[model samples]
Target: MNRIGAHLLAGVFRGFGTNAKVIETYEGLDLGKEFTSGKECFPCIVTLGDILLFMKKERERLGNRFNPENYIYFMPESDGPCRFGMYNKYHRIVLDSLPGLDKVKIATLSSEDAYSLSGLIEKEKIQDFRKAAWLSIVTGDILDRLLWRIRPYEREEGMTDRFIDEAMERMTESFSKHSSGKDLSCILNDLVEIVCEAKKIIDPHIPKKPLIGVVGEIYVRTHLKSNQDTIRTLENYGAEAINASIAEWINYTTYDQVR
Candidate 1:
């Protein structure tokens, strides 16, 4: 859920009978270690560990109800000279070793396949999906902004967090109800008010602590396991730590198109 858009995207996919999820794995470094040879790239290592964790947890909780068909991994691919092209293959090799999970589908939506695979979805659903995807991306950005604006200056711990959860729940509900082309501004306005009311900010009269900016590799920056929980540790020490949101990457890519 690093992009945050994926959380909402999962709902869109769910409407099509595909149960998709975006895993923002925690405490997975050790799990990654246990599952991999330590020679894999950090992203691959972390992803493998998280997938393993999901499979294990599902198997435990669902018992016989968990079906591999219901748990597909959506790994989008590109025509690459880059090693990213190999991720799904490596994932398959590792996953085949685990019983019951060997049948879990690793579905790749490659850049090359859009034309050839367009028929996999109905035309009507594709239009609806486009609309849902747009809203998801925008909503994620709003929620992320709300967190940074409120959390650091929150008058009470957890109150801002509570509003965030409620806002997201309502936002998700709104998205689920509308398939396409409904004006989201009405719901969005309500959400903004909810966030503005997260809590009172710290008194501006008092001296403020130093601010820290986290800057580095995108994967390391997004994954707490990869960064050794740097942001949370900073927040715990009474300073505000700001990291660029994943929306920054989306905007950067979009900028590249125009330039």
Candidate 2:
């Protein structure tokens, strides 16, 4: 969401200078509930709502320093029959009428659009983007799983959360250092050590908690904002909430492509 993370993510731009930002906030759902039609899909409503809230917050922060020209919406679309394919057009249509938003640029990577429309982002950059993106997702998914796995069982209520935050920041620092260009083997060793240390602090003989499986839409299930921290809430209520694994989506995507 901030500089180092964005640099690691967008570094795939091959100096094309793009940044990755994620809208993961509970405030977005509040905005979505107000602005979006009730008929819309929950994920769509949250996505649109997050952008709107982000814009408002940024405007407040920037005040006189704000410039619409500096911001660009990175809304990628998939080659699918789902309504998600229209989000880019929907965003454009909606933003066009909003004051001070018409001038803002949108970088859409849809199957039907000019994929290489941005002169700075080209074929080789696309390959870099793909590799960086996969690493990002895999790293993030493991971190999420680790947090979820240990949070419920921690000796102290906030220990797991605090440790995960520190670990993530450390990971960001590693990413910002561009460790991928060098011997990447030692890059995440500290994070692995942190997780191991965390396991040592947890009570080994704590009574087993009841397990609950989470099943639903991919975004809602895995995303904290969309799901309203349901898994954490369940954990607080004395249960182990097992979220769908990242592998599920990967396999599903592969299956979709093949069949």
Candidate 3:
């Protein structure tokens, strides 16, 4: 599990800056399934599936960095009715079912667990959480924007994915040095600048199209399978798709509840 844990740390750190790569595996199937079985659909599950798939790839690439025979993984766990609480167990089941992966270990980091790996990292460098959160938000926003804009002219089946991987790597390197609050602000500004430049480059190629906003349950909106592949489907039909931020869902469910 040590190797897995190390990979997780590296992944998180990389994810914060831009070196991280997120590959979508189950999106196609998930989208198709959700379109038919409207009920019993969970977008969060789809997102978890993507995360797990990426983790598996990362584990393979960084083999034996910490330990060759055993590997460990971590997933964030939450409480309440968000359905996130069950993800840890579900991920374990899924991973175990994969061939040659029965020995893989999955750990959940709870909000209250100060001794968790992420917690340890945050405690050791208090600025990491803020920096990572900011980077995650900006990167997600950029990818979401690109997916909506380029879905129509995407010559290759998974061109959006390759572009996202490249963008993540670029953005990660851009901010890797600056983890302070001021640096985070600079990163945000730079992200905005990059996005603006990208928009100028893409606007000429993207045709004017109707835009559809997808909103509802948290998992459904973020997970491609849960929402019936709404984004891609919309794009295929000449519609631009905008997915509401997951942070909005968090605020609606938790922050609003607390208030």
In TM-score terms, which candidate is top?
Answer: 2
lDDT digits (tens) for residues 85-127 of candidate 1: 5667888887898887789878765544321224434666665
Per-model lDDT = 0.65, 0.64, 0.53
The stretch of ten residues in a row with the least summed lDDT in candidate 1 is 111-120
Give the TM-score of each candidate. Answer: 0.76, 0.80, 0.61
lDDT score for residue 36 of model 2: 60
lDDT of 3 by residue, 64-94 (tens): 6623235445556666655676666766666
Of the two candidates 2 and 3, the one with more favorable lDDT, higher being better, is 2
Please give, for residues 1-259, the per-residue lDDT of candidate 2 as tens digits: 2222333445333223455455445567777667666787676677777777888888899999988878877766646666766776777766776899887777776544323334436655565445444455556666777777788788877888788778776766565454335344544675577668778657777788898888877667776656678988999899987776654554565566556
Off by over 4 Å in 3: 1-12, 15-24, 27-70, 90-105, 111-122, 146-165, 180-182, 202-208, 225-228, 253-258
Model 1, CA-based lDDT? 0.65
